[model samples]
Target: MNQHILNVKRRTSLVTVFTLILSVQLGFIAYSGELKSRVPPDQLQEAQSLKNPYSVTKEFVDKGRILYEGRAFCSVCHGRDGQGLPVGPDYDSSSQPLPTNFTDGAWQTARSDGEIFWILKNGSHGTDMAAFMPQYVSEKEAWQLVTYLRSFQGA
Candidate 1:
Protein backbone atom coordinates (compact mmCIF):
# COMPACT_ATOMS: atom_id res chain seq x y z
CA MET A 1 0.00 0.00 0.00
CA ASN A 2 2.79 2.46 0.82
CA GLN A 3 4.61 1.61 -2.45
CA HIS A 4 1.38 2.16 -4.38
CA ILE A 5 0.89 5.54 -2.67
CA LEU A 6 4.49 6.52 -3.44
CA ASN A 7 4.03 5.62 -7.11
CA VAL A 8 0.91 7.77 -7.34
CA LYS A 9 2.69 10.70 -5.73
CA ARG A 10 5.60 10.37 -8.10
CA ARG A 11 3.29 10.30 -11.10
CA THR A 12 1.46 13.35 -9.80
CA SER A 13 4.70 15.23 -9.36
CA LEU A 14 5.82 14.34 -12.88
CA VAL A 15 2.48 15.42 -14.27
CA THR A 16 2.71 18.74 -12.46
CA VAL A 17 6.18 19.37 -13.82
CA PHE A 18 5.05 18.56 -17.32
CA THR A 19 2.07 20.85 -17.01
CA LEU A 20 4.22 23.69 -15.79
CA ILE A 21 6.68 23.28 -18.65
CA LEU A 22 3.87 23.18 -21.16
CA SER A 23 2.28 26.27 -19.71
CA VAL A 24 5.53 28.19 -19.88
CA GLN A 25 6.07 27.17 -23.50
CA LEU A 26 2.60 28.28 -24.46
CA GLY A 27 3.02 31.57 -22.67
CA PHE A 28 6.34 32.22 -24.40
CA ILE A 29 4.84 31.46 -27.76
CA ALA A 30 2.04 33.90 -27.11
CA TYR A 31 4.34 36.57 -25.73
CA SER A 32 6.88 36.22 -28.52
CA GLY A 33 4.25 36.58 -31.22
CA GLU A 34 6.33 34.10 -33.11
CA LEU A 35 5.57 34.19 -36.80
CA LYS A 36 5.55 31.18 -39.07
CA SER A 37 7.39 31.13 -42.35
CA ARG A 38 5.55 32.46 -45.36
CA VAL A 39 7.38 30.19 -47.74
CA PRO A 40 5.48 27.20 -48.96
CA PRO A 41 6.72 23.84 -47.75
CA ASP A 42 7.47 22.58 -51.25
CA GLN A 43 9.99 25.37 -51.71
CA LEU A 44 11.06 25.77 -48.09
CA GLN A 45 14.23 23.72 -48.38
CA GLU A 46 15.52 25.58 -51.43
CA ALA A 47 14.47 28.93 -50.08
CA GLN A 48 16.18 28.43 -46.73
CA SER A 49 19.37 27.31 -48.44
CA LEU A 50 19.69 30.58 -50.36
CA LYS A 51 22.46 32.86 -49.15
CA ASN A 52 23.00 36.58 -49.74
CA PRO A 53 25.53 37.12 -52.45
CA TYR A 54 26.20 40.74 -51.63
CA SER A 55 28.13 41.64 -48.51
CA VAL A 56 26.34 43.47 -45.71
CA THR A 57 27.65 47.03 -45.67
CA LYS A 58 26.44 50.55 -45.04
CA GLU A 59 26.29 51.20 -48.78
CA PHE A 60 24.05 48.19 -49.42
CA VAL A 61 21.82 48.99 -46.48
CA ASP A 62 21.53 52.58 -47.69
CA LYS A 63 20.58 51.42 -51.16
CA GLY A 64 18.00 49.13 -49.67
CA ARG A 65 16.66 51.97 -47.54
CA ILE A 66 16.17 53.99 -50.69
CA LEU A 67 14.22 51.22 -52.35
CA TYR A 68 12.23 50.41 -49.24
CA GLU A 69 11.22 54.01 -48.57
CA GLY A 70 10.96 55.16 -52.16
CA ARG A 71 10.08 52.86 -55.01
CA ALA A 72 9.24 49.83 -52.90
CA PHE A 73 7.15 51.98 -50.57
CA CYS A 74 7.63 49.38 -47.84
CA SER A 75 7.59 52.12 -45.23
CA VAL A 76 3.96 52.78 -46.07
CA CYS A 77 2.90 49.53 -44.41
CA HIS A 78 5.98 48.43 -42.48
CA GLY A 79 6.50 51.92 -41.04
CA ARG A 80 9.72 53.90 -41.21
CA ASP A 81 10.75 52.38 -37.89
CA GLY A 82 10.08 48.82 -39.10
CA GLN A 83 7.55 48.29 -36.32
CA GLY A 84 4.68 47.84 -38.82
CA LEU A 85 1.81 50.23 -39.37
CA PRO A 86 -1.87 49.49 -39.14
CA VAL A 87 -3.50 48.71 -42.40
CA GLY A 88 -6.18 50.92 -43.85
CA PRO A 89 -9.78 50.39 -42.83
CA ASP A 90 -10.53 48.80 -46.16
CA TYR A 91 -8.10 45.99 -45.40
CA ASP A 92 -9.79 42.62 -45.11
CA SER A 93 -8.50 41.26 -41.86
CA SER A 94 -10.10 37.87 -42.47
CA SER A 95 -8.03 37.27 -45.54
CA GLN A 96 -4.70 38.88 -44.77
CA PRO A 97 -2.45 39.03 -41.75
CA LEU A 98 -0.85 42.23 -40.53
CA PRO A 99 2.48 43.51 -41.75
CA THR A 100 5.41 42.04 -39.84
CA ASN A 101 7.29 44.08 -37.26
CA PHE A 102 10.94 43.88 -38.22
CA THR A 103 12.02 45.20 -34.88
CA ASP A 104 10.82 41.96 -33.31
CA GLY A 105 14.12 40.29 -32.48
CA ALA A 106 12.50 36.92 -31.96
CA TRP A 107 10.86 37.13 -35.35
CA GLN A 108 14.09 38.32 -36.93
CA THR A 109 15.96 35.39 -35.44
CA ALA A 110 13.25 32.98 -36.48
CA ARG A 111 13.29 33.92 -40.16
CA SER A 112 16.13 33.27 -42.55
CA ASP A 113 17.70 35.60 -45.10
CA GLY A 114 16.50 33.29 -47.86
CA GLU A 115 12.97 33.34 -46.54
CA ILE A 116 13.03 37.14 -46.75
CA PHE A 117 14.52 37.04 -50.24
CA TRP A 118 11.88 34.56 -51.29
CA ILE A 119 9.17 36.83 -49.97
CA LEU A 120 10.59 39.71 -52.02
CA LYS A 121 10.68 37.57 -55.12
CA ASN A 122 7.53 35.56 -54.63
CA GLY A 123 5.56 37.72 -52.22
CA SER A 124 4.06 36.41 -48.99
CA HIS A 125 1.33 33.88 -49.53
CA GLY A 126 -2.13 34.87 -48.24
CA THR A 127 -0.96 38.39 -47.40
CA ASP A 128 -0.99 41.79 -49.06
CA MET A 129 2.74 41.52 -49.73
CA ALA A 130 3.26 41.54 -53.48
CA ALA A 131 6.32 40.65 -55.46
CA PHE A 132 8.75 43.53 -55.81
CA MET A 133 11.45 41.69 -57.69
CA PRO A 134 11.51 41.98 -61.49
CA GLN A 135 8.93 44.73 -61.14
CA TYR A 136 10.27 47.48 -58.90
CA VAL A 137 13.59 46.02 -57.81
CA SER A 138 16.28 43.72 -59.14
CA GLU A 139 17.72 40.64 -57.45
CA LYS A 140 20.69 42.57 -56.13
CA GLU A 141 18.42 45.29 -54.80
CA ALA A 142 16.28 42.68 -53.08
CA TRP A 143 19.32 41.21 -51.33
CA GLN A 144 20.27 44.69 -50.23
CA LEU A 145 16.81 45.15 -48.84
CA VAL A 146 17.22 41.95 -46.83
CA THR A 147 20.43 43.35 -45.36
CA TYR A 148 18.64 46.57 -44.50
CA LEU A 149 15.89 44.61 -42.81
CA ARG A 150 18.47 43.03 -40.49
CA SER A 151 19.26 46.52 -39.25
CA PHE A 152 15.78 46.64 -37.76
CA GLN A 153 16.51 43.87 -35.26
CA GLY A 154 16.20 45.05 -31.62
CA ALA A 155 15.20 48.48 -32.86
Candidate 2:
Protein backbone atom coordinates (compact mmCIF):
# COMPACT_ATOMS: atom_id res chain seq x y z
CA MET A 1 0.00 0.00 0.00
CA ASN A 2 2.85 2.39 0.87
CA GLN A 3 4.56 1.65 -2.47
CA HIS A 4 1.35 2.44 -4.37
CA ILE A 5 1.04 5.76 -2.53
CA LEU A 6 4.64 6.62 -3.35
CA ASN A 7 4.07 5.89 -7.05
CA VAL A 8 1.03 8.16 -7.10
CA LYS A 9 2.98 10.95 -5.44
CA ARG A 10 5.77 10.58 -7.98
CA ARG A 11 3.29 10.73 -10.85
CA THR A 12 1.73 13.89 -9.41
CA SER A 13 5.13 15.52 -9.10
CA LEU A 14 5.93 14.73 -12.71
CA VAL A 15 2.65 16.24 -13.92
CA THR A 16 3.24 19.37 -11.87
CA VAL A 17 6.70 19.80 -13.34
CA PHE A 18 5.41 19.27 -16.87
CA THR A 19 2.62 21.79 -16.37
CA LEU A 20 5.06 24.41 -15.14
CA ILE A 21 7.34 23.90 -18.12
CA LEU A 22 4.47 24.10 -20.58
CA SER A 23 3.14 27.26 -18.95
CA VAL A 24 6.50 28.93 -19.14
CA GLN A 25 6.85 28.10 -22.83
CA LEU A 26 3.43 29.48 -23.63
CA GLY A 27 4.07 32.60 -21.61
CA PHE A 28 7.29 33.13 -23.48
CA ILE A 29 5.52 32.78 -26.79
CA ALA A 30 3.01 35.45 -25.76
CA TYR A 31 5.60 37.79 -24.26
CA SER A 32 8.11 37.32 -27.08
CA GLY A 33 5.46 38.68 -29.50
CA GLU A 34 5.66 35.68 -31.80
CA LEU A 35 1.95 34.95 -31.46
CA LYS A 36 0.91 38.52 -32.22
CA SER A 37 2.87 38.50 -35.50
CA ARG A 38 4.12 42.08 -35.52
CA VAL A 39 7.05 44.20 -34.53
CA PRO A 40 7.59 44.98 -30.89
CA PRO A 41 6.04 47.98 -29.07
CA ASP A 42 5.62 51.42 -30.71
CA GLN A 43 6.50 50.26 -34.21
CA LEU A 44 3.01 48.91 -34.70
CA GLN A 45 1.57 52.06 -33.16
CA GLU A 46 3.53 54.26 -35.58
CA ALA A 47 2.62 52.13 -38.54
CA GLN A 48 -1.03 52.23 -37.57
CA SER A 49 -1.11 56.02 -37.37
CA LEU A 50 -0.37 56.73 -41.01
CA LYS A 51 -3.43 58.47 -42.40
CA ASN A 52 -5.00 57.63 -45.74
CA PRO A 53 -5.33 60.47 -48.21
CA TYR A 54 -8.83 59.32 -49.06
CA SER A 55 -11.78 60.76 -47.19
CA VAL A 56 -14.06 58.90 -44.78
CA THR A 57 -17.68 59.60 -45.73
CA LYS A 58 -21.04 57.98 -46.26
CA GLU A 59 -20.30 57.73 -49.96
CA PHE A 60 -17.07 55.99 -49.11
CA VAL A 61 -19.00 53.59 -46.91
CA ASP A 62 -21.30 52.83 -49.81
CA LYS A 63 -18.37 52.16 -52.04
CA GLY A 64 -16.83 50.00 -49.35
CA ARG A 65 -20.08 48.10 -49.09
CA ILE A 66 -19.97 47.35 -52.77
CA LEU A 67 -16.37 46.27 -52.61
CA TYR A 68 -16.88 44.17 -49.49
CA GLU A 69 -19.93 42.47 -50.91
CA GLY A 70 -18.79 42.13 -54.49
CA ARG A 71 -15.08 42.30 -55.17
CA ALA A 72 -13.63 41.71 -51.73
CA PHE A 73 -16.15 38.96 -50.99
CA CYS A 74 -15.74 39.55 -47.24
CA SER A 75 -19.35 38.72 -46.46
CA VAL A 76 -18.96 35.05 -47.32
CA CYS A 77 -16.47 34.65 -44.52
CA HIS A 78 -17.18 37.50 -42.12
CA GLY A 79 -20.94 37.45 -42.57
CA ARG A 80 -23.04 40.45 -43.66
CA ASP A 81 -23.30 41.74 -40.07
CA GLY A 82 -19.64 41.15 -39.24
CA GLN A 83 -20.74 38.55 -36.68
CA GLY A 84 -18.20 36.14 -38.19
CA LEU A 85 -18.89 32.66 -39.53
CA PRO A 86 -18.02 29.32 -37.98
CA VAL A 87 -16.55 28.10 -41.26
CA GLY A 88 -13.47 30.11 -40.32
CA PRO A 89 -11.96 30.45 -36.84
CA ASP A 90 -12.55 33.76 -35.12
CA TYR A 91 -10.10 36.20 -36.67
CA ASP A 92 -9.27 37.23 -33.13
CA SER A 93 -8.90 33.69 -31.87
CA SER A 94 -5.45 33.09 -30.42
CA SER A 95 -5.34 29.71 -32.21
CA GLN A 96 -6.33 29.30 -35.88
CA PRO A 97 -7.91 32.71 -35.42
CA LEU A 98 -10.94 33.59 -37.52
CA PRO A 99 -11.99 36.99 -38.82
CA THR A 100 -12.67 39.80 -36.36
CA ASN A 101 -16.16 40.28 -35.04
CA PHE A 102 -16.78 43.96 -35.62
CA THR A 103 -19.82 43.78 -33.36
CA ASP A 104 -17.75 43.41 -30.20
CA GLY A 105 -17.85 46.79 -28.46
CA ALA A 106 -14.93 46.05 -26.19
CA TRP A 107 -12.75 45.12 -29.12
CA GLN A 108 -13.83 48.15 -31.13
CA THR A 109 -13.06 50.39 -28.21
CA ALA A 110 -9.56 49.04 -27.92
CA ARG A 111 -8.62 49.44 -31.60
CA SER A 112 -8.05 52.72 -33.38
CA ASP A 113 -9.31 53.62 -36.83
CA GLY A 114 -5.84 53.75 -38.28
CA GLU A 115 -4.92 50.41 -36.71
CA ILE A 116 -7.96 48.79 -38.26
CA PHE A 117 -7.04 50.24 -41.63
CA TRP A 118 -3.51 48.90 -41.39
CA ILE A 119 -4.71 45.41 -40.52
CA LEU A 120 -7.08 45.52 -43.48
CA LYS A 121 -4.27 46.54 -45.78
CA ASN A 122 -1.57 44.26 -44.43
CA GLY A 123 -3.60 41.26 -43.35
CA SER A 124 -2.76 39.06 -40.36
CA HIS A 125 -0.14 36.38 -40.92
CA GLY A 126 -1.11 34.04 -38.08
CA THR A 127 -4.68 33.84 -39.30
CA ASP A 128 -6.55 33.07 -42.51
CA MET A 129 -7.20 36.75 -43.29
CA ALA A 130 -5.25 37.94 -46.28
CA ALA A 131 -3.93 41.26 -47.54
CA PHE A 132 -5.99 40.91 -50.74
CA MET A 133 -8.42 43.45 -49.27
CA PRO A 134 -6.03 46.22 -50.21
CA GLN A 135 -5.45 44.74 -53.65
CA TYR A 136 -9.11 45.16 -54.43
CA VAL A 137 -10.11 48.26 -52.46
CA SER A 138 -8.53 51.65 -52.86
CA GLU A 139 -7.11 53.40 -49.82
CA LYS A 140 -10.25 55.48 -49.70
CA GLU A 141 -12.42 52.40 -49.91
CA ALA A 142 -10.54 50.76 -47.06
CA TRP A 143 -11.04 53.79 -44.84
CA GLN A 144 -14.72 53.70 -45.66
CA LEU A 145 -14.83 50.10 -44.59
CA VAL A 146 -13.30 51.18 -41.32
CA THR A 147 -16.15 53.57 -40.73
CA TYR A 148 -18.72 50.94 -41.62
CA LEU A 149 -17.01 48.48 -39.30
CA ARG A 150 -17.25 50.96 -36.43
CA SER A 151 -21.00 50.94 -36.84
CA PHE A 152 -20.96 47.25 -36.06
CA GLN A 153 -19.60 47.81 -32.57
CA GLY A 154 -23.00 48.70 -31.19
CA ALA A 155 -24.97 46.31 -33.36
Reference-based TM-score of each model = 0.75, 0.66
Off by over 4 Å in 1: 1-34, 87-94
Most accurate candidate by lDDT? 1
Candidate 1's residue-wise lDDT over 1-155, tens digit each?
99999999999999999999999998987665447678888999999999998888889899999988898999999999999997779988656678889998888998999999999999986678999998989999999899999999978
As a TM-score, model 2 comes out at: 0.66
lDDT of 2 by residue, 36-150 (tens): 4333355687766767566666787787777766877888888888888776343445567566677877678767777777777778656687776547777777877777777
Supply candidate 1's per-residue lDDT for 129. Answer: 93
Displacement of the residue 40 alpha carbon in candidate 2, Å = 5.4
Candidate 1, RMSD to the unseen true structure: 4.9
Give the lDDT of residue 130 in candidate 2: 74
Candidate 1 yields a Cα-based lDDT of 0.90
